[model samples]
Target: MVVREDSVETKHEAIELVLARLLRLGSLVAAALLAVGLTAMVVGLTGIAPRLITAGLLVLLGTPVLRVAAAALIFVRERDWYFAFFCAVVLAALATGILLGRAGG
Candidate 1:
């Protein structure tokens, strides 16, 4: 019974390790997409290149955001309210920056 309940600190660490592994895999896939996109662009495949590039960029950009989110969830589950609050703030800031940058560009 007692053994069935996992502690928060250890859970946080385990989640982080999994996220790290996922991030690496995501990076590899993103790179492949980028390469294919660029190759298609060079070969004048009009419809596919930009889409592939966009997909790659989305994956790259989203990975960190996902990391923050996962951390936030873990923090919440652990009842680490302060860290969870800060994570929310960081996410808001990041979203605002992305929105502003897109609008400005």
Candidate 2:
């Protein structure tokens, strides 16, 4: 059976959607790794336990910060409103986390 033109277009769109999601997910993972690696390095350099623990917590909680920051940069460059909104919310959460973590510390 021959595939219709509309069917091909729909398939192509679906593939693009999947690719975009994968790219975003990959970005999030990479950002998490970067934050974790940076924290680990700082912990290794400094022999302070509480500071190290704080850094670890910050890295863990800041994963989304990196993710959103990456997305925000992309959205800003591309002028994407919806993604920008997502970035705003994620950044707000990151800010809240920072405030709470500081207070607790």
TM-score of 1: 0.71
Q: Estimate the overall C-alpha local distance difference test score of candidate 2.
A: 0.62
Best by TM-score: 1
lDDT of candidate 2 over 1-105, digit per residue (tens): 146645555544443454466556666665665566567666674445445456556555645555567667666554557978887887898789889999999
Model 2 spans with C-alpha error above 4 angstroms:
1-63
TM-score of each: 0.71, 0.40
CA lDDT, candidate 2, residue 53 = 53
Task: Estimate every model's Cα lDDT from 0 to 1.
Answer: 0.87, 0.62
Please give the RMSD of candidate 2 to the true structure. Answer: 8.5
| True-vs-predicted CA distance for residue 41, candidate 2, Å | 14
Worst 10 residues of 2 by lDDT: 10-19
Error of 2 at 61 (Å): 6.1
lDDT of 1 by residue, 3-99 (tens): 4346554445666687788799889989999999999999999899999999999999888898899889877876779999999999999999989
